[model samples]
Target: MRHFLRPTVALLFAALALLTHRAHPAEHAVVITTTSTLGAAAQAVGGDSVSVETILPPGSCPGHFDLEPAQVRRLLACELFLRHDFQSFLDGRLLANGVARDRIAALPAAGGLCVPDTFVALGRAAAEALAVRLPGETEALRTRAEALAHEAQTRGNTLLARTARLRGKPVAGALHQAAFLRWLGLDVRCVLPGGDDPTPGAVSRALTEIRATGALAIVGNVPSGRRLPSTLASRGPPLVMFDNFPPSPRACRLLGHARPQRRPPARRAPRIAPCRTRSSPSPTSPSATPAGHCWTTSRLRSHAAVSPPCSAPTAPVRPHCCACSTANSHPPPAPAVSSAPIRPHSTGAAARRGVAESA
Candidate 1:
């Protein structure tokens, strides 16, 4: 009984210690990112060791976003700041706000986060930066970063296999979205002009390229395409828009894990009714003229040559070729051809000469 009591007491103390560790964990490093892309990469590598805060909305255009005073101050106070070089607006603001240059880590603006290789590169860069700032968790961050990169590569390969059917399919897309489209194994023939509104000449050129390459669809992005969507949709192939940012950091694993939405079924064109006619005389018959028939003269001639009756109506009247309904009545006779010589009209002097000649 005394030996069993000692073991139970030891077990109780171990459980209490485990709960205590979990309840009061180490403080997380404060990470600030200008965009969700960088924030996602940072979080993916840092995991629970860092608390990531994104300055720009994931859906907004990163280049055009305005940083508020509070956000600027936050950037100054954060343990680390990650960003891309494309946000030139931040250069002046960060300098004026007295934010240390060493605090900010700039990433390249190359391929989108959706690409597996690009995502892996982003993870590695993020891990390196994080490891430098948080030296205590360097090994853990590096390990997680490698795992993340591996997962992205595996998922991307799987996606590539699944999208085998779409490989080499021609597509037109926005310049910014070209990388993602290429990653999806699409053949990007041309890119649209940059900005909200494109010139008519540019639109014409894009249309020409689309026709030449036989593009099945035009891919657009969420940013800077205000009028392009409607214009392209009205004049070109179907437009599909891809998002630039993921909804969450975890969603940045090349592509989100969510199942794709099913496209709506296509609408079929209404079928037309077949034309019907009655039996007619042979082509040799003089009365086989097509003056009253809805069918063309050549068609009537061919029908007369065969001397077979037209097909009978099998459905409602919505004829595509001709509008004439079933004709049970006989066809009208052909006009007579005369061989008489021409004569002058009898009037005035000509009338007197004509009377004399007749007499």
Candidate 2:
């Protein structure tokens, strides 16, 4: 009777445990990231271990984004939130919208200059925080983050190594990227915005520095176009517009590869104003054109003409001239003018004259 009671009690305990297990199932962590940059890294690290959602699309300023009802719902459901400088980003938006503060996690903010080094650093932090939230994914999350970091660092060093040729070449760039420019081995001489908005004092200082450093290349932010010093505009340094931010975090890897156009050697071919010849070719003949300066010069030589009139800059200057052999070009060649040799009064000269005369 005691043995029977023991078996019955054990069976009842097993049944109760099975019922409790069925009542609660494990849930995947829901992650919400504010920016695409952080969201991309989170996704790379989280893999399938966590469900990640992004709030801001690339290129949207945080101040401009107002949360919609659907987005707010998505945010409230998330178990974790990642943002660069989350305090300023979220403020009380999530809390006021009914999200518990405990679930939100702020990793260290990686600043501007979206090079691989910056991303790699942020990835590790994001992965670590995520591991804490989803203990079951600790190993996978940490491993993925480290692997990402390692690969990025490797790619960064390789990029730096490849850019060794740019070392010591002085440049003036957007204030935010001065350090990064130097890191890539560029010599940063003067920064733009010059502590000055085209102010006289700023202009004076910038010009002086430009002279001092011989900085012929001015790197400007792509977003802030044509804002260079007006005084320096027509005759200033070659303004190099740099796109600091790519469309997405995944594209951030392309940083540092942008380069300013190098002034072509002093012998760069002069720009040719597009011009069409006054004449057109016949149906049976394929028309040919001469190179710009060469064509102009050759025509001028033949015309013994005045300076080529400056052709009105046609809208969308097209290649009005196809490069062709001067032989096939317009203005057909002058027929050869041959003269018979003069006959000499004496012996050998007469023979030569006879040969020339074909007699």
Candidate 3:
């Protein structure tokens, strides 16, 4: 009887331990995300209630993300998966990998939750899903988020106002960014030549027009690579960099509530030195000047006479007279001049140039 009693007590203890383990299951929920940006948002919302796992690392191209087998399994085991509808890589893969629709949460539709508002709401929802109660102090967090949203709106307005000063001015950049700037009231002349990166030639041509028309700004995604913005900045006008992701605190702070940099007044190129010819009576004299110091054939012709009636010793003779003299003087060599008309390339021409012009 004593031996049976000892074995029974041991069995009872083992059963009690099993029951205790079952009663106190793990407290943390698992959250799976395709990118760190989304993972950060999930963590913000989940707070201490959930652990986040990002399948893609920072700075990785979101378009071509591929999940590992282990990551897929981990995702399947997670309590929830947060996804962005526009995320091509993650959304399709998750569905194909057999993740149930019910276990996923799509972000609020566009226009519903923007910037800081989206972040706060997502955080609250994640906490609620885990049955985690926020402390009374959470009211302060809510207040802060509201303040941030107001500040963002104010900043956006300020940016728009500055941009307004250059109303009707042409702008060009990434397609999505162009649309955003357009929404802010900018006249987007065109998108950068390629879908993402513009070729060197395309950039050169675009910059030429942008400079010619005096574009108000050249906007692009900051994370797209600094080369584009750096290139644009060096060329002319100011580059108004925009973040592709919804504004985060970091982004908001970077953009700030300050008004956009005032569009520096356009600087006109200095007039070229008037062309002079040796055939003229006073070869050192200035050539015929056209409107605003521009040299034209008509103005040059007006200045042609080599004799004294041309009056001013400093006045230049007509360009045609100089050309005629040159033709007679040097018959062997004709000055080569291109007959091509100066016209802005059509969109199709620019597109073709874009391919050949890639940096």
Best by TM-score: 1
lDDT of each: 0.53, 0.46, 0.40
Model 2: what TM-score?
0.54
Indicate whether candidate 2 or candidate 3 has the larger lDDT.
2
Question: Which tens-of-lDDT digit does each residue in 6-43 have in candidate 1?
Answer: 99999999999998765433346788776555666676
Candidate order by TM-score, decreasing, is 1, 2, 3
What RMSD, rounded to one decimal, does every model reach? Answer: 31.1, 27.6, 24.1
- Candidate 1 pairs with clashing backbones: none
Candidate 3: count of backbone clashes, pairs at least 3 residues apart or interchain? 7
Distance from true location, Cα of 237 in model 1, Å? 0.5
TM-score of model 3 (CA atoms): 0.47
lDDT of 3: 0.40
Name the 10 consecutive residues with the lowest summed lDDT in model 1. Answer: 298-307
Residue range with the least summed lDDT across 10 consecutive positions in model 2 = 298-307
* Tens digits of per-residue lDDT for model 3, 32-126: 76543455445443434456565532223344444666666676777777665566456567778998766776554243222333434544454
Question: Against the hidden reference, what TM-scores do the models get?
Answer: 0.63, 0.54, 0.47
Candidate 3 worst ten-residue window by lDDT = 283-292
Clashes within 3 Å, all models in order: 0, 0, 7
Which candidate leads in lDDT? 1
For 190-217, candidate 2 gives per-residue lDDT tens digits of 7776322566776676777777887756
**lDDT of model 3, residue 301:** 16
